[model samples]
Target: MSESYAGKINRKLLKKRRIINAAAGREPADLVLKNATYVNVFSNELCHADIAVAEGLIVGMGSYSGMREVDMSGKIVLPGFLDAHIHLESALVSPREFVKAVLPHGTTTVVTDPHEIANVMGTDGIEYMLQATEGLPVDVQFMLPSCVPATPLDESGAVLDYRAIDSFYDHPRVLGLAEMMNFVGIIAGDDQPVEKIVAAQAHHKKIDGHAPDLVGNDLNAYVAAGVYSDHECHDLADAIAKLERGQFIMIRDGTAARNLEALVPLLCAKYADRCMFCTDDKHPSDLLEKGHIDYIIKKAIALGADPIVAVKVACHNAARYFLLNNRGAIAPGYLADFVVIDNFQDFTIEQVYKRGDLLVDHGVVRDFPAPEVEPYLAERARNTFHVETLTAEHFSEHRPRGIIGMVNGEITTVDAGYSDRIDVEYDVLKIAVVERHKNTRHIGIGFLQGYGLKSGAVATSVSHDSHNIIVVGTNEADMAAAANRVVELGGGIVVWDGGAPKAEVPLSIAGIMSDEPLITVNEKLEAAKDAAYALGVNPGIDPFMTLSFMALPVIPTLRITTRGVFDVTQQTYV
Candidate 1:
């Protein structure tokens, strides 16, 4: 049923012979780019040559002839961009649709974590994403979710221990364990997280970190436990500390948590090699309207970073860190994946090639077949929301703890201690977290300040880590109505006003992603934002995205869970 070792060696030898023949110009290359000026990653400079492609591998870069040729006289070719870290599920579309949005932006490869879906569907969600991304023109690699339920304080649909994900390490696309969000657990030598770190090390897989502001001996303990990278640094000192301690810093510039501007100093020559670019949670609107990694590269160049250094951070550094040896360069023996840009200053992508095949031409991605998902997985993903019907009384809170204050432009909240006043005029609102998994009917009620909601309610099943239904509103009735609407839609974001849903976007797949085109998802999201704005939500913060992070118990200060308003630092209910 399989070839023998000798047979495999002979087959490889024969292929190598053919590649050598093409390189020596004894035989014609399958395709060649004539008069090309490509970035030489090895030399850290631009050079002129004729690139030869055969069998999807770059065989040579000197004078070469091919059966088919394209004259690329004036264009500049840089290695195709690679996203160091991202959660593809955060795009709120299927992998196929996400690829369509980013391919034209010159993102030929992405390393994604399916933790959002994993928190909902468990291993089934991971399997669905793997199957969905297989065989696409853009390469999709994975880092298994290191913390499924995130922590013991919150309730999630499923819990994945290391034993549960050990088998996934064998998959070719699976790089390593994803962001280990349980930094506290790992530092304390907790059995659960320690075992995971040991297992990843056993397989020689990379372990990523998520310690927001860890310092001193605690940071040392976390790094000593084998977590090699982090994307959560929000300042220069924090990033530099981690970099000096041998952790690769990922400069994140996503829709919700943007740290690129603060971490740009790491893009300089002193620390550039140890840094990479990532968009941890890019919403559909941002992806479609602005751009993907290309947008990051352009922004970096505009922010006083050298074009070559920025490009290297976007491509080569990430590839080397992730151990993807075949790509991230435009040299011999690498995969023929690169982007043709007009120039370094503007960095406007003109064309994109993956394995020598033009996938995006003139900013338009060619149509491709959507990946087939297993019938059972699709059926399972659609039925993720399991909650009972709720009435206005379910959201009623007679006694309230301290207000969970919303920080402008940040997910971190502050403890604006006990406000007994129900003052809607001072921008105070009622916020509730309903347990949607297991139909527990558990609800946590609290008051929120700085939301700026004058009337109506906004609810979403996209709550972070746990994904419980979180709603913020002026009245209990409207909050109940919004939560009920989210459940009725199977799973989605909803804005309810006047006893009805004003705008909604259904995410049927694991209550986090849609199978529809990204354009449709983006349009729906924009409409939802408009509806929230009309209800008097703050103009500065993202209404839905800000609400989604309220349930996550890992972040510092105060957060809401199915239990109640919690103090993350003290590890207890307020």
Candidate 2:
């Protein structure tokens, strides 16, 4: 029979019949996992069951004969983890390589906001991410980026207005509008943002939110505008308030920001269903050393959270919030996605099965064929690093009373007291943000006090919100060399010392991700970190990741952009 004609037949009915036959032992199942202890999220209990899979759905969860069977003796079977929110671009690897890195860690699903790419390449960037993630072992879902440039205060490479955003509403992989980082616009009832929210609602799609420290009437107004979820809460009070206001809170535990400790208290039985886990931005080093949602689960358990509730927060809560009804639970008719672990406490994933196919075995990811990269994607490599000229003079700035701040373990920055000059004695350094998108030759110069760089410089084109080139250094010559080197590589992170490149990780893909494998990317990142440490950067912070956030103008207190130093509290250029 022709494949088209065969597909046109009642395949749904035939699949249902097959499932019924397999469960009834009249037909052999495609795969059977026997002698396993299932962590049933639905009932919040453990059950010894033999899982029978037909096609790609759970046909039954009892002793059954099958065409193929694997004895999962003494193993604990849990649903595959779902990362509620993440930025795949932040991994510094393409979606193809990112899947390879996280599959062994048991992350089978991810809902990603491609705003980082959208800010750089506009709608074309969003489409590229969707196309790249097709047919992967992990279930990659795209959340339509709500804010392309993030805010009107700064310029991005491309703009995604309501008209441009509406085009992806019907895309099969599009879950909803991404985190609306432009909370200021939404609170003010701006026409552009308000219209986007209405369009998402009209299409019955959920809208994610990104309001950091938003409270009082403003928070109410922001939520009232139909923004449904938030992943930026850093404390318990804000988390409690958002939960009370009917917003699903994504407890984030990533390399830069670690809020899981403070928010773990909120993951109690009372709010277990409303809380989910997300790594908003995690580098490959962190993703590999510490697992994704699996890491979050381990931390939550260590913090005295119930093991079952922690698992629910990692798996069930995310699935429920995203309306992924088919894969969160190990029940009949659900998608056959399982994470086989030794126990719930340590959360050591031994094997992972997606759609009845084993993808990870013995804690190592089974190699799956990667999708072909279209030739047009290679064309995007040119003209990304558009900086014309960068010099030591660009890093010179005199602000006796101007103060910039840095916060530990958080993206938010605070103002340290003003300084008379670049006080290298006290660890103050010169920070510059160079505009790379339009070759505007615009550079924003300021002083940062916490980098601890006594000499040399660090630079990256992976700046947040607006992916400009941002560099910080003790000496202007090193700063100039580092910034120019980043532009030279098209885009990536670089650390320089003694007026030469110390270490570099090239992210040639839209100047945000490397086309290299995850292992190579991780090695480069580690070397970059070592170089930063050698340059006297504070060991407490991930220098490259921290430098990336310094350019984010949306975060509070003080931030630098290509336009100028922005006071986030005052919401204007200082």
Candidate 3:
């Protein structure tokens, strides 16, 4: 027999023998949780039982004695929640810091798309994230970024081709390809995307989808290209259509885009099996205030979803879909990853254990210190922020044809038609996207409303997709100062007023993530928000987040880039 086949048989037999021994009282379990009402996601039932674990796998789940045991009289045990899709870099904290913020909330696994970091540092960035997450309490699985720049219309620091991505498929934590944001290219049968899809499929890896508002034959064409999942559905109709077409819909509840409420109606019995939950992009403030996947579960239950169904969506669905064969349940041979809660209604987590080890106790993360980053990885942060010398004259708009209107919550923008002259009095402020990568000296200037910046200016190197320098302000000099300040700090978010920086958050890791503790980063971010509000930016809007999305051309209506104003609906620059 072949070596692979022999190994498979030996593993199956070994598991069966161990399970039998543990159940028959012939072997003592490593750990046991007695008298717990654990959820059975497969049967959709809550059964009172004792769980026996050994070597990080559940060997038995019945009456059993163990070397260590805990009495759970009334608590509910649940499979650890999984975030189907997320961008860890968007939290503005390094992977170590990001896990520290979310693990206490019972998110054991997160499928992260590192395209944000990939755009800035390429494969090295992806490797840094992977290395940082090693041995952490949270299982951070990676999806190789499918589109580095997101599209050719924008310039990015690094470019990842199919050959480059093929090398990462063999990594243990790399699950599959990230979202294919280049939907236009996929539909046009572009050789580059097609080959990437083919390469992933050959390895039997999953391909995530990113078609926002795409429907009809175009949707069919994109699906036919082997994209298995999508998290970009903004409405019920879109969700329904994609579900009917055999696409797994990931209901997203993120920092800027809150679609869970709008799409929760689709989480009913008929379609619950085809749905999962993800936070495609989230900020630190939201993660801290509202719990991670726990927040989604509570909200879904409050909105009248069956508590078990919501649990399935948060846990089982993602694991099965992602082919994480050893997890997603509390059963024999499954990884001993679970959360202890007071009840299903409030879902108040009391403790969390991963791989049979206590990671969080009573809502506090246990002692699992983050590893020191390799010196070579630290060196990658140098020389990233590269913007040409910018001045107030570069931001001045004369006879502008159109303005990029900001929507409060969504990434998409609206193209409010042309204006004859500058109008800062009406809250119409100047917006500019400067090409930071390669120092192209390219600047796209336009007018924006709804920013509510009465004075001063805000800038960030965390621009989505392209990772360029984006600044918005009422005063040209402040805007110029804010933009250049971000460059001088290597890369970060900055707020400038009175011709000086009022507050700044330095993201030294590829201009997107800070290596500092999450608490420190959160403090800096809060300070920046305070400064933004002090400068008369809208109180309801997250000024930094809203400013970041302004340069993403992939989203609808209107967006600005170093090239010029882009009309997403028209699919061309105007």
Candidate 4:
């Protein structure tokens, strides 16, 4: 590591300095941020120090110098934050216009699981995501998806297997396996898919797990089976239990979940080392305003978590767990990834850096790479533009209608929770799934619910996993019309009143996300939320979220996914 010996480095730099130091054999860094304050997340101490860089690597430290210097006086520096789990492809592709929403929040990296796109376009979808995130501000690394259709009962865009896993495991950015959602299969020892885990094991990579409400001997079986992490814990006792069982708890905060408060207390008291933070699935509006994992750090601190411990769980622990040494701490031999924040309580981000490159500054992305994506519109906008043609015929008691009962601002659902059934004879209820995959298959039927929808119909192509078209109504024609309108409008959510359409939020990308900017997406989201309220749905949250994840078959107490109806407890397709 000398000046003359520097040319051999790949994507790194070489520099020469005078420390009259021992022959440790080292070159100078490319750039040096001289005289900065370090918030040592490891020891929770603040120290005034100088950082040096060689090529893109931190080759020197402790009052170091280089060719050029960035005088960071009185500025706060912490490690780059990591987003433990996400769906970058769906996040970027579905809403092509919203990637920057999370970039400015000091979260310089993400461990994304591209299952949403996999369900739509299969392995091709994963490939598309890989291609799309080239050289973006944030390090969009991946965990090779563990579940394609997500559940065995549903048919989706991709069918990933041991071959596909082995194929993608070699890529530099591919880190181990994605969240394994097939808890039942793992417990049953059905190794067809579980072998994928074994394959990653051979590669010596980490394994991420997902088992909602798994407890007692079953939880034991899950952890003993080689799965290492869990993010689906809902209750504090369950989270603490999982932590006691030696599973790293990734406390989650997202559009459908607000578990940070419940899980934060544990991370503060007793088991601080065994926890991390992740946004399982966050919409643009949430990411843009509330934040990525940065919000988690702020929330943890606000709830009595030590600042250093909060930053550790928010930044260092996740990278350490996944063994992503390249980007984590602000120390020498690590990537020059960090955030300059004004405070820890509100967590205001002033600047962000990754691999020594400045990405976001002053609340805006200084640079953003373009992503090329094809829109997946279900049908034209006008095709689904009619109102109720019902005279009370869609009701029943035994053949219960598939209903999506939502929890406010959360993705967890009360599956098939209804005492009422579709009265088909009276034309009171109808349910439909529009094939938003652009395959052009649209189907409609009638259903019932105890959640109580008094009028009109709600439609969306935001169905989870498969993201097919989903419409619920009292009238068959209204349901069919709402579904077709999503197709005709090039994909979006359609709301219908008596004999007319009220509001249509056009989500041109795959019928699930809007290609519009973050602000526009939020506006449309509010409109849809309002429309849902007008329809007599009691859940105060925006309807888009409830509609978007309705097709997700992974988590369950109950759900009405695009693949007909699912019985999660029995682990079978009904």
Candidate 5:
């Protein structure tokens, strides 16, 4: 009992006729904003006009009458902000909770890569997020995880090949392949990476990149393989090099890697068009305390970036890059998504509208239906941990081939060479990555410097790219206890000391996110951080957030995996 193709076409034609009539002033619009000064993204300037809405589309931008009107005489109107790249699971909250935190800040759309959960639950995790984000006020789109296991060095919960994810390309909300973290493999012409790239290219999907310091011929090869964009640019030089070689730049300003200040110079007339704003991985505390994309805009303006250009990068540029052409502008035939603000200086968001419906007013989101979670998916996600009980003997590894030295404010690390003795007095600690997915009892033991952990232990199942259970501690007993506690909670971060848990944040959703409210998660995360700091953890770096990245082998100089400590620069086991 469905309409025929011709019938559907006729129905859409009728709706288009109504929209044209409304724009031509022959019919009353559903809503109108009177005397508005809106940002004209095409013209790159602010223009005064009245915006008319009909059927949730901006049908006109001149004088028009509507059934309902809101006066906007002195306020500034902008297209709703879009996050070019983000990991929603990094917020440590479910899609519903994450929306509540970002919607008030005027982030009406986000293009996310669910690789974090996909590493733990595979395609089922991707399906869970797709269902969890449907029908929310904030439009959530997806890019399929390009590197689920990240690389061959890391052993994740699941291995995603091209055949494993080919059906996802047909999804309406799926944009393309996510970040291609295996740049080395691609440059070397590896078959696995090449096959995935060729498959996505065949579907005409955008392929995102993650080449950090790649330059010269290697960079050319990466772009030649048809990668469209990159969010891993850490400096202006790196971004400019990629931009000149035909790749869109995603200026990342996130929790562990704050690259906005370093790349602020790229927000100019010459380069701003190719740039977009993204919080690649924002933590719970940062999302609640600091704003989302709105925070990036404010900081860009503060760093002497032109207000108008910054707004364009935050809104229109991302929409254009992601090919969501319908909702990024205020012109006719575009969706009526907007962010009304007091001014650009404070960048204070006053009201937000999504498809002509007022979703947020005066820093508060209106009531809407939360996405329905299927009972089976919810049960499957709640029980992702599959590790056997652990003892202190399992963590007793004295010899470490190499040590990972943490960068103060960045996720990138250093090859701190090797040391046989555990020097607790010199801020050296023991770190281990336990393979919790298959429970093969495979543990990679290594030493860590600059973590500043004097005593006790901390463990989290939120390790990046792989989502393995990674723990760091002063001794084997505390390390084993902390890691076991994480398994006991199904999946979570635990801070243990004196043979007891100090604080814990349970992430029952695929070992990465919680279904609780944002504020509650933030409270628990902050308490856990405090407990970590009390145990002599570094105050400069986020304890759990930074620890989570130690297992990501694609990042930089050195990293850890379930196999062993690997030197990323040399591409070999240390």
Candidate 6:
């Protein structure tokens, strides 16, 4: 804005002042790009213009008079990329860590889902993240996590009701509700103590959706329910269907990188209207090696999407769809959020500007403060231990609780299945939940299968939903020793066998992610994953990812949360 986020221009007064001062003969242009072709996503028109930026806003954009200008001469200028869907804290610990990872790719702003941490620590976690990202190289706006546990089916750490959602509405950095993952409950007509959709509607905030593989009548009903956007489409047809229903389809490529290739076709002129790009959930390894939203733009163009179409998916459409009038374009009064490309192919970044200041030059964060955020949830690592039994009877004590199945890479999962109700003769399965909090001796036990290793035990504090310690074993002694080690080391995911732990990754921060640098952590985690492969665990499409979602009652087919088990088809706890 000429006056910094000013709503309306005092145009008549300014026009009079322009006559009196003559703007001091245009002054000296603070920065100028000479003879660059502007990729106007709004008009789909290519124009050669000399751009002048002053006071951080594009004060003049036209054929230039002789002015001080950087020699752009032949480079292209498109609006900087935007990540319409992503979770930054989930991707890495701090904003600088993430900006270091993706800024060179031309992504200058991100719409994040912080509901993951909010699920564990409630409002406190949300504020910590917000304070940490106050003045970053990129604009960091949050969509208040719609569901803290994500759904009422589980015992999530905290519940964010309508009032809680409303309380954050005017918070300077807040956008709207994060992806509303509970489509099954919404469609099944379940009215509990509170409805997330009701909160979004009352506050007039956008409610992002997460409905994977929803088809036929259910998909149509979900659209009508007033959830406006989704990033969970795995196929092109799914993207097209949701776009047809007026839901902005966020083509996502997170750690798993689904839908980047499958749905690039939707950026077709027929449907480019509602297309956008998102990272959804990326581990730091992926963020470091593979680019963020810029990687998607290149992939889409490589897959034959027009360069303009790809840029629109990454920038224009997200802004237009959500009515984020302040950005998504390089016009007057919009945020000074744009990128100056050094070159296009292989995409070398030159400089980045956010809120009208040069913050990143040649991919390095410039003049920014590193946030001093302490690991506040340090005690939760000790609380991770809970259940105290080792025998098969301990797991089966409560009528065979739900077992999680995972299919690596795919985000959704198969429903929770029943453990065979045997006469206690055969060694079938056992599962455990290691509390990553300060309960080292506590372990939650249950029975499960599908990893196909009942003769041995597979243990991990990476249990989904509550992030507690979960181990599945045939022998009580093996399960006990494996679960005990996680508590001993504070918190981590581990696997074990008869006498010793096979592999482990200590995650001291709320049991979900590590405060340790991701590269160090992912290397160890991958080593453990490789070990699971040697033990006959099928990776790349195994029961791990599916098991995490098994507890998520939001996605269809079936899911299980920290609760006993959710019958998503019945929209009730089984």
lDDT tens readout by residue for model 5, 425-448: 988888889999888899998889
- Scanning candidate 2 in windows of ten residues, the lowest lDDT window is 377-386
Question: Order of all candidates by lDDT, from best down to worst?
Answer: 5, 1, 3, 2, 4, 6
Which residue runs of candidate 1 sit more than 4 Å off their true CA positions? 1-14, 419-422
**Weakest lDDT window of 10 consecutive positions for candidate 5:** 392-401
The local lDDT score (0 to 100) that residue 5 gets in candidate 4 is: 40
lDDT of 3: 0.87
Better of 4 and 5 by lDDT: 5
Winning model by lDDT: 5
In model 4, the Cα lDDT at residue 173 comes to: 87
lDDT tens digits by residue: candidate 2, 537-560 = 888777988878888877778988
Error of 4 at 439 (Å): 5.8
Tens digits of lDDT, candidate 3, 22-89 = 76669988889999789898899898889998878888788988989998889999989999999998
What is the per-residue lDDT of model 1 for residues 1-574, given as tens digits with 9 covering 90 to 100? 8999999999999889888899889999988999999988788789999999988889999999998898889899988899988999899999999999899999999999999888888899899999999999889999999998988977888899999999999999999999999998999999989998899899999998899899999999999999999999999999999999999999999887788888887888799999999999888989978899989988988898988888889999999999999899998899999799989887788899999898888988889998889899979989988888888889777885668999988788999887654578988788888988788888988888988888899999999987889998898889888989998888899999997889999988888888789999989999999999998998878898988998998887899888889998888888
Prediction 2 TM-score vs. true: 0.95
The runs of at least 3 residues in candidate 5 whose Cα sits more than 4 Å from the true structure, single-residue gaps closed, are 1-7
Better of 1 and 2 by lDDT: 1
How close is each model in CA RMSD to the real structure?
Answer: 1.6, 2.2, 3.0, 5.4, 1.6, 5.2
Model 6: per-residue Cα lDDT over 289-408, one tens digit each: 777887888778788888777877788888876667767776544555667764556566677766556667776766566565555533542243444434444444446555444444
Give all TM-scores, in the order shown: 0.97, 0.95, 0.94, 0.84, 0.97, 0.82
Model 5's lDDT to the true fold? 0.91
Give the C-alpha lDDT of model 6: 0.65
What is the lDDT for 287 in model 3? 84
